[model samples]
Target: MTIDSVRGAPEPELVQLLTPEGERVEHPDYPLDVTAEELRALYRDLVVVRRIDLEAVALTRQGELGIWASLLGQEAAQIGSGRALGEHDMVFPTYREHGVAWCRQVEPLNLLGLFRGVNHGGWDPAEHGFHLYTIVIGSQTLHATGYAMGMQRDGVLGTDRAGATIAYFGDGATSQGDVNEAFVFASVFNAPIVFFCQNNQWAISEPLERQTRIPLYKRAQGYGFPGVRVDGNDVLACLAVTRKALKDAREGQGPTLVEAFTYRMGAHTTTDDPTRYRLKAEEESWKLKDPIERVKAYLVRNQLADTSFLDEVDAEAKQVATALRKACLDLPDPRPLAMFEHVYAEPHPLMTEEQERFAAYLASFEEASA
Candidate 1:
């Protein structure tokens, strides 16, 4: 994957295609080799992701969900890496990666339940090959590293079929100790894990400058792995770079550090206010790089779609939001006792006592005989 270096530098050019206005450009070395169908599929992925993001935010406003992390601008970074993943490739994601969960076929509503304070995790990670969204910053990186080491022990690396892991963390997480340690372990052991850092340029109120002085990709050099930046807003670039990284890892080429340079177009969460820390001019700047608009531009420029198609895509995005709204409002409240069903394989005395006490409390509320 590290084919050529930048002029007088050790790293290659940060690969990018598809300008903010939707012009399809090409990388000198990492030319996109996907078909038109694949390109359109990327567009579809972005549409649905944005729809889910909007809906989740609305649910939080309606008080149906406890919290929501909106990935409004980082759609391309998620979809590109997500679509590039094989079915068997395990994904370790930090919370707010709703787009990645969507790419893995996790039911959109499953996400709401977690935010609704109904359950610890809405979807089983094993079923989707996506670990439960880790709340602690950058902790999942170590989990991915350990798992990748296990994959090596299992002798799955270098096999064409399956054996790649991806750890999804935020720009802020890059500053965490575990993320750095993960890189160290992965490099020494030659673990087949892809460290995907989606640098959305904001950690709550702090800017990217607060997180790093140099481009994030440059950090990979100290760990002895290839690190490269990609235009995270460019869907094609995300897929091309991440796919190559995973492929190289699987082929025993070792780990990769992919820093997706992107922006957080929305607030950190429904509870935070960007206006307090960021400027309107800054938001306007990222708006020019809207992930959805670029794909729409591509469709129009390539004659793949017209006004009618654009209208249809809009309708679809709206329909998705409406459906999510209805579903979240009507979602059944989980049985109080259901929470105790999967806590442990072997019986835990403390869990059993808590379950019984909670069940009795629920029964008391069910009917008060007069």
Candidate 2:
């Protein structure tokens, strides 16, 4: 059954700039003026990020990674929202936010290492303005709320130099107490944050219908914050809506909940079998609304990008996949004791003692073997 049928209600109006047929439509509320160059760049971002995702899935299948969460059909929701962030803005992302990580300049290899059990996303969050992926259901929302409050206290809110924070979560996370608590805190404190929810239709096996009776975005209204639903498949609409939301937060307008209504075209992760719960026909229907293909069509229809440009993008995607594979293969396994090293900022006596004891234990193994 389609998501609309599951809701048993009419689908709410979504902010859309592009139709499934590749025709660009105008939205009075969210106006987006993009040049040909910008369009090309956005298309490139979508294509490259998708390639990286595909490669990661391939690696997992090849036993290079223990597990991987695929973002097969949520490219526009991610890349569009990711690209909307300001340079100084911070982002808290869920485990499946590889696309946002890419926009934040976190290398794909760093993500691969996390899945491979080598390290906890080797890149520093402060350096990249992107927090490490949060595997917990919805805890990152609290972290983002706290950080945004911190920014407000630091006298950064309502300024031209304001740096807003965005917390990325899925539809499933909305049900978590942590997410609800975050909304309350953000609203009461007027935290300069944007809660970007990529509602990809399924939170694992549970469909969107099971998550809530009303639409996900509307949940924000009760919390006293503005909420918007955007066509997650339309990259331009996502970009426009997110840009406005971030701008509003920076200007001290408080939190905004942006629901990017999209679908998951593949299994939730490499470990999932979508065929068991969702219908094959449903998947085929969403395929027609493919985000990348729409952008390509728009480009081709306008004669902005010819076959040569398309071929170049495909070639570039292959090169990126090659580099990512090499990087993943070259990663060295961390020593067993490495995990204890970064547990605290300053070395504590108890930790040091434990580390020594662990070292002794490891040494005893070598002695026994000898």
Q: How far is candidate 2 from the true structure (C-alpha RMSD, Å)?
A: 1.7
What are the models' TM-scores? Answer: 0.91, 0.96
- What is the Å distance of residue 295 in model 1 from its true position? 1.9
Model 1 lDDT per residue over 218-325, tens place: 899999999989989998899889999999888889999998988988889999999999899978988898887898888878888778766776788888888888
Per-residue lDDT tens digits of candidate 2, residues 1-370? 5555454778788999999889999999899999999999999999999999999999999999999999999999999999999977999999999989989889889999999999977898999999999999999999999999999888976676789999999999999999999999999999999999999989999988788878889889999999999999999999999999999999889999999999988888899999899899989999999999999999999999999999999999999999999999999989999979778899899989999999999999999999
Which parts of model 2 are misplaced by more than 4 Å? 1-9, 349-357
TM-score of 2: 0.96
Model 2 residue pairs with clashes: none
Candidate 1 global CA lDDT score = 0.86
Best by lDDT: 2
